[model samples]
Target: MTPDSLSRRQLLTLTGSAAAAAALASLSLTGCSDRYKLRCQHQRTGEVYRELNIEIGSVITHSWIHSIELSRWTDIYRFDGETLMLTSTEFEAYGAGMPLDEGDVSVQDGQVVIENIDREFEAIRWIHSHRVDYRIGVDGDESLIDTDALPDLEPLELRPK
Candidate 1:
């Protein structure tokens, strides 16, 4: 073969090798190329849950309604490079003979905070009512919740199969 042809072949091989190496480097930086399956279940009712299959740098929201009470639950999460962080979650339930409940949970500084309110009838004639509120912070954050911005329960983690 001509020298020129030989030189061109060597250049092509080098270029292909460089491309493959770059791709492998990218895969290594991403840790795992496979998508992870994430799941979070209700704290009270184990039957209610949210599931997602996702990869790093992905955001997902899963919601479902209780089969019997028609209560709703929604969870939003974002997968950072290392962990899946909870952004927000909400649960609301209203039914006969049950207290009207609303709950919210949010993440702040790598910790989770929760606020909830329950309302129920105080008398048989429905002439009186009562409300109870709760605020909780998890993950070593002791800061009190802002009463005005009280928001909504389950924590979720993503795992590789």
Candidate 2:
């Protein structure tokens, strides 16, 4: 065959290769569009720290010490597949910045707790500090993130990916 033309077998092989490539491209572009994940990153510098595959109705909790009260406090979050919701907060003791005299109040696990806040947040940000002892918990597994290693200027954030 001439250089500009192909034999019958060569033409068929080339056509098959092109068709296979097209199918792979389409599958890659359309596959896993509904997959959900939780992305954690630095708010100021936009440095990603971690990405955890999550599902609907997942729970994420942040436990830290109150700067003023010097007592431990925990903020609970729930994933609705599209966004994160601040469901409630637990306090070892009622202190500054807490609703002591009003709103829903309850007790759980021998600690003073509140429930049913029902607030929706697009993302959560916190400036990590060595003193406050920031801890993030996904489901029942803790120690997924380390706050002390991150710098102060880069505040940590949690949002949907």
Write model 1 residue lDDT over 8-44, tens digit each, in one string.
Answer: 3454475576764665566557654444543333233
What overall lDDT goes with each candidate model? Answer: 0.39, 0.74
Query: TM-score of model 1 relative to the true fold?
Result: 0.29
- TM-score for each predicted model, relative to the true structure: 0.29, 0.72
How displaced is residue 137 in candidate 2, in Å? 0.7
Candidate 2 residue-wise lDDT, 1-161, digit = tens: 43124434564476676764554455448643336777788886777888877767889998888878777788888999678888888887775667765447888875677877778888888877777788888886777767666666457788887
- Candidate 2, superposed: residue stretches over 4 Å from native: 1-34, 100-103
What's the lDDT for residue 21 in model 1? 61
Q: Highest TM-score: which candidate?
A: 2
